[model samples]
Target: MRSLYKIVHTTCQTGWGEQEQRIYNESVWMENKGHQVVIITPMGTPLFTRAKEHGFRVHGVSFKRFSSLKDYGQLKQIFKDEQPHILNTHSKADSNIALPAAKKTGVPCRILSRHISDPVRNTWNNRKIYKQLTHFIFTTSDYTTQHLQQVFKLKDMEIFSMPSGIIPPQDLAPKESARKALARDLCLDATTRFIGFAGTISKDREVDTILKALKLIQSQIPHHIAILGEGTPDCLAELKTLAKDLGIGEKVHFIGAKEDVWPYYRAFDCKVLAPGNKNKIPLEGVPLALLEAMYSSCPVIGSKTCGITDIIVDKKTGLLFDPQKPKNLADMILDTIANEAATLERVHQARELVRKKYTIDAMGRNIIRIYRLHQVKIARQYLV
Candidate 1:
């Protein structure tokens, strides 16, 4: 049996996205494996409330500033009380506050979970801040990890790549049953093949591009699309209007944000993840949603940009499309429907890959290994 250790995780975000979910999943798994896990968050945030409800020891601290003595005092008190073996902080806000508190309390291991592919600024201040950390766990193996290593140049700290894991779908109804439920709820046509998308309908999501692709293919192939996320009212209205203008308003269904999107995965014949809009310094990573869809046995069509290619080896695990071209996107979708056998084969491969590499248990075990290694390193340093 593995020895248990206390782990403290902090995320200072109000909304619950992939980062929050990753923390929750890993924390639950760690607790179940006999490790003590506590979550620190701002009071009444979704992450704090959910962590509490799920039986985690949660400390709520509203941090005004990273340098605030009051905030530091509160966090230092929590660290002293918990004495966690590992202090893992996610996001810029949480890390800013948590790092100082951990340092003050002499926390054994400091781990930063960098979930985005945003570039790390190569400034003296940024380097100083990063040098204080002992480890980095990046969501992407390629961009974020490489960028940080080049910029931070931390000689002592270890870097790890661990993608967010999927909670295996429990008690998922049969595909036909799920599709029927979706049809009943969303008033979708039973006969129509459904293409699914389950991310924010923002510019980065390229929801507009998907709508345009669907328009190009509508005359060639008729399909229903179920969008299962939310954005601002104006953004949502714009997408709806765009669909209408493309003569696909009737075929497209915006189901808004869903608390449970797993069941609806069964309703999709094929899922599309359009490429993100490029920025000066593009921020992109493998979306956890794509992995979840794969886990649900849904064959995915993802854009070639970003870390998507890391998992999707075009026509192997999933199909990749050029997001810049709407016609290419249309062809990929059409080909997926026409080639059912190939699609199913790809889905099976994806499901197996996810099961092997991307489960909460796998992630927790890998992380625990890193924590142990860090502990050993710290001990060796003290001995020397």
Candidate 2:
């Protein structure tokens, strides 16, 4: 018989980005598999509201830094009341409060999920939080797991690199149809070819790299790039200015954030992720967008850095280019456009990889296996 576990997930983030979406999707997966799932987030936040609407038991606590005494108290109480078999914290602020509460309340399986590839400083506080407070750590990518191992000198078994998985779409519109629909919405001609980017619009994301690459090939290729996400107003303005200055403003369409991006992925001639590598802390994890794009049978191009490399296998599954060089990206985009047979071959390979490994079912089952292992270990300890 399968043992059903009550799992409590905590995240401090208010935004509905990839991390929050992962938590929600995982919670839904857990629930469907007969587990009782609880969410703890700040009151009135998007996650809190969404979880509540989805009929999960939710507790709202302000996870503010340094003044988290109230948050800690509330979490400790919730831990005692809920007695969850697994307590998973998703962000630093939430982890700081919730892990200790779980520890004091004797939660058997405490986990801290690190979602980004950002570098972790080896501070005493960090050491205690990562190594002492949590029983196991879940990172979104191997790069992050290895980085944590180096910083904390953690054993290999103590950390798991489990990227959030996607549910492969069942009924997607045909590529040409999707393209024509998107073109109509964007007020472009049905024949217009689109290169697409669907992620947060930030400096670290390096959307400008795509713009620069587009500028390089615009005259020759005569294609438009649809950016299907938003950023801070300043960032958006700056990008628009850069596009204008490069004389490709008309070619770049900032579609802002969309409720449904799968259509955009389907509409794309090729999808790109171009996160820069200059930051001290790496920002990209195994990006879910790229996985979705690949599963959509869209050809993908990514900067050869961070977790982007984990999915795009040079020229096999997808193409990669140096983020530092716009020409490299331009050349790769041109290659994807020019080589129809090669690009389609890579797209098929990429889709197969996603179906085999990157589905939500795969991730949920693996995580359940980990939970069961810990449950057995705890039982043995109790018997002893």
Candidate 3:
């Protein structure tokens, strides 16, 4: 077993996405097992500050993506000071900062986890670093690494697939009251069938496609959409206009964002995720939002992108729709509503699948195994 000092670095802690959440959640879990997991993140709010004060260590560093050479060199000083046994960097940009630090400190394990599958940053310089400086390039999917290899020729035994695991959203029967209260606050009819969606509804979401689909189906069914996200003014305005043009503006309510999403999940009869490919850069992988939705006994409809395919089994646990077709989203939504038993049975299976394969505890165990394997390899290398 490795010592109780494994330091990881990322950008910040204000945003509560999978990338930020997992890094801390896994860190805390490892800490519980007597390991110290320090993360190099920017400042957090009072709540996050309190949590850190309790036990977990948070190192503040202003490491921006478009930073100068001095930024990386400054972070390198942290590695030298900490002398961490393992240095795990979350993003590729952050990897750029952590790379030299790991090299200069001679940290045995420097793992870079690729959370997104964007091909834009799969650069020659990064590939060379993966070949030479970095210890391993840990990716979320084999499909992701395959594309990276095809485009940038970053191939190695060191490149491995390691997905972030899903934690079942907290269960709350009393929380049902909170869901009803939110509906009341929104002025939604007590009888309306509410379908919901929650994610980064930016340009990549293509939520207008879902809106068009909702328009197609609204004439036949009495349903409401409860959206949960915030984005730029332009994208948000475009979505509002799309809903207004579809004649369902009043029926669709934008909930923006909430710290606790379980209440929203309980209020939703179904969940929808509509993602568009940003250029050829495929947005693939099992998103935690979909897993949380499924875990909450809600059926789901997702796009056929590689990442989402890992969890969504069409007509089984959830439905897969063509992102380009307006009617496809409508058809799937209607079908999911029509077959409530099958839809719910799929939810049950999805929850079970997550329990077996995608729990945070399972992910922690896998990560520990990977660390041990790498450590053993390191030990044999310098026995002379």
Top candidate by lDDT: 2
Stretches > 4 Å off in candidate 2: 278-280, 382-384
Who is ahead in TM-score, 2 or 3?
Answer: 2
Q: Is candidate 1 or candidate 2 better by TM-score?
A: 2
**Which prediction has more favorable lDDT, 2 or 3?**
2
Q: Against the true structure, candidate 3 has what lDDT?
A: 0.75
What candidate 1 gets wrong by more than 4 Å, as runs, is: 154-157, 280-282, 382-384
Q: How many clashes show up per model?
A: 0, 0, 2
Clashing pairs in 2: none
Clash pairs, candidate 3, are 284-307, 285-307
Per-residue lDDT of 166-197 in model 3, one digit per residue for the tens? 76656544535655766787876556668888
- Report, for every candidate in turn, its global Cα lDDT versus the true structure: 0.81, 0.91, 0.75
Instruction: Show where candidate 3 strays beyond 4 Å.
Output: 3-5, 12-16, 42-55, 64-69, 120-123, 151-157, 174-179
Candidate 2 per-residue lDDT, tens place, 272-329, comes to 9998765655676899989999999999999888788888898899998988799999
Q: Residues 1-384, candidate 1: write the lDDT tens digits.
A: 237889999887778888888888888888888889999888998889889998899998876564467777889999999988888888787787788789889887788888888778987656655776545554454666667877877442467677887888667768888887888887656666688999877877788888898888888776788999978898899999999999889988999888888888888988899866466444466678888899899889998777777678898999988777888888899988899899999999999998888878777778878877776776788899
Cα-based TM-score, every candidate = 0.94, 0.96, 0.89
Residue 304 local lDDT, model 3: 77
